[model samples]
Target: MLGLIGIVMSSEDPNNTDQKTRLEMLNDSVIKLDSFIEDILNYSRNTRMGVVMEEINFEEILEEIRNGHKFMEGANKLKPLVEIIQKEKFISDKKRIIVILNNIISNAIKYRDTSKEESFVSVFVECDSKKAVITIEDNGIGIADDKQEKVFDMFYRATKLSNGSGLGMYIVKETLEKLDGIITLESSLNKGTKFSIQIPNQTN
Candidate 1:
């Protein structure tokens, strides 16, 4: 990748279309490799480390996640609507929860249904002291009925739109298992996808 970058940099016509395309491709490859490495590290962390309990600030973290992806293409189209109803303080593994939400949200953005004029991702959370119920819904290119069951399976790519090694949802499943959480999904071919995840709140 470095050699390719050097070549692109040293090109006689710096603005050449072919060189620009090659550089773009190289940049994409780097991003993909970085995502894969992060996934691996996440897998190790979720599998090996014990859950560290902490108070969860839902609104703050959700906003943080939204800000992190504002630079993504089409992010502007998918406005995130967040609704939080919390009667009591929610306690859980903060990092793990962030990981789960980030993966799902990123996928929603990447596989968004471009045919629609209005697209949105809504996150609704209702929690008491016992557990947290999170629903993330997106108007995007959804998984087919047949493929939905196997989405959490290792390296399963339900659609060609998937670019990763398909470990995103696998790691999500693993992390949820570690947290004693339950995840369910609903989707249509081109309409959208909704994910409902519930995890027990740890009392510290």
Candidate 2:
């Protein structure tokens, strides 16, 4: 009876361990998913919420984003490779523009190749007669050629190791489409990724 009891306890120990591991993983996944959902809410609120559109300063919006986000700060903590090549002021809704810039910049910071010696990211802004273009590029682990299209899909991750809810790009795509804009991606694995966004200057 004593031996049987000991064996039962031993058997249960492994089960408990497995259960604990699964629970922790689930919790982490939930947290990541929650953050992703919050980002979507922010994007939605920027457009759908009861805020009237007004003439906004893009430089101020970018500055406010730079000042508030801790993630970008950390990205530049080690030798500071992230760079804003150009900044521009545009006449648009402040909240909406902020949401668009924040999402793109946040991902650039988050996906940076921390292992590299010169981890860097860049943002460029240009406005012309017809439209405005914003480009965000990063020297991070880029997407594979085949999986590039999948990045825009909801809840799609290229690898099992990705610790994310996989909704960032999806939200980005949806937001741009809603705003009558288009986003283009150029990427190569181990090289990097560049996202070029073009939006019309006229108000909707």
Candidate 3:
């Protein structure tokens, strides 16, 4: 269905303004459907796989997530404020951690409060010999207190601002559990949201 919609949209007459606008909306829907499908597949795969913990440089992962080519355009516009208070080798599933960071960071950008004079995301990392704690805070339209607890549930969407598959947070929580990690959230309606993730450090 999505592929058919894309083909129809692509073949539309560019001179027809009304048709163009409708087609654009249809295209957006198709893109979202595609994302939803991908997220479901990822969630299933990660759930079935065993965690492969390895020594990884925490800062390097953050750098890749913030400045990576995939996010360069959005990061440039969002101007996320990332402060790595501690950078060191940690033991965890690198890929899963990246997925968690990417989803939260992207949500911060996607749901930014345009009403604010300035929109920003701040990331703080703190770790000890036992575990690593990552706090991602965003000055974006926040999750209402009533809805906060459900954010990690599969197919749960907190706000209309969410465009992608509602599976992002679900995947994050499931992946963390696989890694023996946990997450918590704090938010006030219209204020912002903060997510704190803690993963056990298995380094010897």
- TM-score of decoy 3: 0.83
Per-model TM-score, in order, reads 0.91, 0.71, 0.83
RMSD of 3: 3.6
Local distance difference test, candidate 2: 0.67
Q: What local lDDT does model 1 show for residue 171? A: 91
Residue-level lDDT of model 3, residues 42-118, one tens digit each, is 79779788888888676788788776434222455565677665555578888888888888887887788888888
Residue pairs clashing, model 2: none
User: Which candidate leads in lDDT?
Assistant: 1
Question: Candidate 3: deviation at residue 85, Å?
Answer: 3.5
- List residue ranges in candidate 3 displaced over 4 A: 1-16, 67-76
Error of 2 at 26 (Å): 12
Ranking by lDDT: 1, 3, 2
lDDT of 1 by residue, 1-204 (tens): 645665666764865878677777887787688788989999889988999988999888898899988766678888788999988888889999989999999898889998998889999999987899999999898889999999999889889977887899999999998889999999998989999999998874
lDDT of 2 by residue, 100-177 (tens): 777767766666677787776677777654567888788877888999888889888875556666776777777676
Best by TM-score: 1
